[model samples]
Target chain A: MPKIVNHEERKRKVAEACWRVIQKKGIEQATVREIAKEAKMSVGSMRHYFSSQKDLFIFSMQLVMDHVHERIKKLPLSGPPIKDAMQVLSQVLPIDAERRLEMEVWFLFTSKALNDPDLKKKSDEMDDELYQACRLIIEHLTVAADWKQETERLYALVDGLAVHAIMRPGRLHPDLLLSVLENHLKVIGQNV
Target chain B: MPKIVNHEERKRKVAEACWRVIQKKGIEQATVREIAKEAKMSVGSMRHYFSSQKDLFIFSMQLVMDHVHERIKKLPLSGPPIKDAMQVLSQVLPIDAERRLEMEVWFLFTSKALNDPDLKKKSDEMDDELYQACRLIIEHLTVAADWKQETERLYALVDGLAVHAIMRPGRLHPDLLLSVLENHLKVIGQNV
Candidate 1:
């Protein structure tokens, strides 16, 4: 049998290579050649998947979002509502080594997006979706509450927790993260 | 009287020049030559204040922390505890253009500090101080409560709010930031 080529899978391999390069070196050095080397492929092969660094970055950045959404979709919603909610929220925090890396890369990409228009547009749209997700969770659990204010507060809390947990994981311990989140739910008197 | 040449004041002026360069161009472009041009000083004169970009960045970064501390120190703390706390917290958020610019510069400098040992040490210390400030406010507002956890939550909330408000001021809105802070205070049941 002849060897089969999987274009989608190959492109994803390239994107993962991009992530590894970004992790090992800083974003400043995430050049196409370096990424190709990281992926263990020729620069010519990388050109087939991504013509430019911007295209590669957009795909890699999008991969981060897709990964997050995939986890959310796989969440066990059959558990107790508050527990399920906490579990869902914890998925977004850097509670483990793998998550911490993703969060770090996310921040770097977001910062880079500050100067790149296409990335900025995508970042803004993604943030709006996250804000909406925050609002929906609050709506499901709270009654007679100011959903708007709560959404802002919860969004900020999650964002802040992710940042500290990613940057100072030693201090912002994972168990501590869960408990603080649970405490927030208790404080808000979220319905069980 | 001889013209009084204030070395300390002049150094700050140079730091501010660095900020303008960072803001106008970026942290990467904030070279000594560019900063000197921005400061309207000759490169030879600029060398007198900062031996290298590292020295200049350390000073510039410290100046940002000092500015925040100075503002917090000047806050009127005699009002109701929650209101007073919100006021103190508000100083950290970017409600206006100037503070927003400061926050952007702070993020860039902090990111740059990640690979630089001296800046990393200083960044960690500054972050610890800020975390301590968060603990103090939580302790002040509540009696016999879990100040440690609340401090983490509050710190995260404030930091998250500031990042969003600075980056997406048009959407986050100044009033929304205030109300979100107020809502967090109310959730903790600071006062009736």
Candidate 2:
């Protein structure tokens, strides 16, 4: 009998390898050949999974998004709106090792997305999702006169904190990240 | 007699060409050979200005830092702390075409700096400068109980606004940028 292979499992493994290559080297080094070597698979077999480097990148990025969505979905929300919102927002921030790696790869892909149309579409979709998420949190928790601006502010703050945390992990600790978010929520909890 | 050439002027020209290349193509395409071609100079001559691609990248990124510093130094304060602070902060944000290009290049270099020690040092210096700038603005403007947290909050917000403006210029307009910053300053003006 022929050997059975799980296509989705193999593709995910390849995408994870691609993420490692990006983290160790840089996105420029994340070519199909390099990823295949990293994944311990032949380049030809790699092509079996992803037809082109662009497709691989798109898959790798989409995987990161999927992981984030999965985590958010699995989060156990408490009673308080502020506490629950903080828990939800923390899903996207680089608060832990796994999320940190995701944010780093996401940052690199976001930069590449600027020049690649296909990657840009994926990047924009993620941005819209985050924006909508922030809007939901704001709409649920705040009675601000201009909730639109509040939503934008919250969205920017989350992204900004994630970038800073990725860059200076020592300085922006997890406690600090939570504090800033909590403070922000309190300030925007009601019309100031 | 031999013709005299301005070294600094020529180097600045090369760096600007490098910026154009980075902006047009991705940073991966900003190789020394490609940069020389973009600058209309021979690769051999390019070595005289920049010893290596790393040096070129450092010089190019430093030039951006210098530009921001020069603009901030030249900004005329309007006496009010909030207004003056907004103007100062706006220099770093992608509020205009020139700044937008600078930020796009900065964002690419920042991502590249992750696995690069030399570039990471330069990136850290810029982060420190921005952090200190935020602290100064907070010190001059607010008496928050925990000024450090407030500083971090403002710093993250400024950077978040910048990244958003770069990614979605159409959605995050200049007026909206100012409004968000202004609102943030006002919120952080007095102790909560």
B29-91, model 2: which lDDT tens digit per residue? 898889999999999999998998899999999999999999999999867899899989988
Off by over 4 Å in 1: A1-4, A42-45, A190-192, B1-5, B31-34, B42-45, B189-192
Give the docking tier of candidate 1.
Answer: medium
What is the DockQ of the complex in model 2?
0.77
Best DockQ among the predictions, by candidate number: 2
Instruction: Indicate the docking level reached by candidate 2.
Output: medium
The candidate maximizing TM-score is: 2
Q: State each model's C-alpha RMSD to the native.
A: 2.9, 1.4
**TM-score (0 to 1) of chain B for each candidate:** 0.90, 0.96
With a 3 Å backbone cut-off (N, CA, C), the pairs that clash in candidate 1 are none
**CA lDDT of B6 in candidate 2?**
91
Count of residue pairs whose backbone atoms collide, per candidate: 0, 0
Error of 2 at A170 (Å): 1.1
Best by lDDT: 2
The DockQ of each candidate is: 0.53, 0.77
- Looking at candidate 1, what is the lDDT of residue B151? 86
For A118-145, candidate 1 gives per-residue lDDT tens digits of: 8887788778878898887788768735
